[model samples]
Target chain A: MIVARIIDSIWATRKAEELNGFKFVLGEELTSEGNGKRRIVAVDIVGAGIGDRVIITTGSSGRKMLGDENIPVDAVVVGIVDDDCNFK
Target chain B: MIVARIIDSIWATRKAEELNGFKFVLGEELTSEGNGKRRIVAVDIVGAGIGDRVIITTGSSGRKMLGDENIPVDAVVVGIVDDDCNFK
Candidate 1:
């Protein structure tokens, strides 16, 4: 898993069925040490934007973002941080 | 840390007063064992679709999705999987 922040979101008028009722957000990639990275990506969820702390999933886990075995996905945000996280 | 997939994306013209450009996806939460979980949540990222494997970060990492203290968010997609993940 990775750390990041939802920077923004994009809304598409026409999309696939797999994207029905889904949400997306733009986030900056953060390292495990809790530092920000240079790359930025978009997420498909809701209630996140422009400065909220967040958790991101990468790798195969990211591919799993959708289970239709058809939708082409690479990354995904799984959980939202309710408060400061403790990994100790 | 948790694993999930980006199921879908949603677009809203009249959004929270907080949301501006965030993307959202409905993903089925997955456990560390590589198995899908019962609970399904929305993610915020793009370029991801159903059936695509993905990785997700939880806890404080999520709150950082937006970086904004005003918007309310819990999770955010950070990275897109090019292939599979290997943790050792």
Candidate 2:
């Protein structure tokens, strides 16, 4: 899992049938090196909001979080980070 | 999925119970710009060998490739690259 912050939400009315009812959010990775920023469109199942720190799982593992293997999702928000966790 | 090359193998005897019997291979991403090399430890399921180009899925989607959601895996080799596809 990678740490990221929800930047915004995506609204796509026309998409694959398997991706219906899933909320998509754009997230920017929070890397230690502070290198080039990488963004990912992740499915939100944890009710995360914009600006919230989150843990995202990518690839097939992300799709599995949605309980579907054939879903065209590559990233998904798995957990919301709290102050107790050290992101440093 | 991201394109990568199998660089080496990892052997860990003591790991999570759900991660037993899985072969972990080190992979380096094959990016277009040739930026800093990104390495990932991915589970091998498609019989990819060292030096072979393969496709990797990260996060839970990667875990789903193993047919188990509870598996403590972050990456998985899903396919072997051939000459037909343009990785450029």
Best candidate according to lDDT: 2
**What TM-score fits each model?**
0.40, 0.54
A1-88 per-residue lDDT for model 2 (tens digits): 5567899999999999998999999998764355656888988877888998776666665565455668798777765665454423
The deviation in Å at residue A41 for candidate 2 is: 0.2
TM-score of 2: 0.54
Fraction of the true interface contacts (Cα pairs closer than 8 Å across chains) found in each model? 0.00, 0.15
Query: DockQ of every model listed?
Result: 0.03, 0.11
Across residues B1-88, which tens digit of lDDT does each residue of candidate 2 receive? 8898887765544334455687767677788886655655678999998889999987656675677775545777999999677756
Question: What lDDT tens digits, residue by residue, belong to model 1 across residues A16-53?
Answer: 33445666555656566554233334455545656776
- Residues B15-51 of candidate 1 have per-residue lDDT tens digits of 7867677776666654333443544454455456766
**Docking quality category of candidate 1 according to DockQ thresholds:** incorrect
Question: After superposition on all CA atoms, how large is the RMSD of candidate 2?
Answer: 8.8
Give me the candidate number with maximum TM-score. 2
Native contact share for candidate 2: 0.15
Q: Give the clash count for model 1.
A: 104
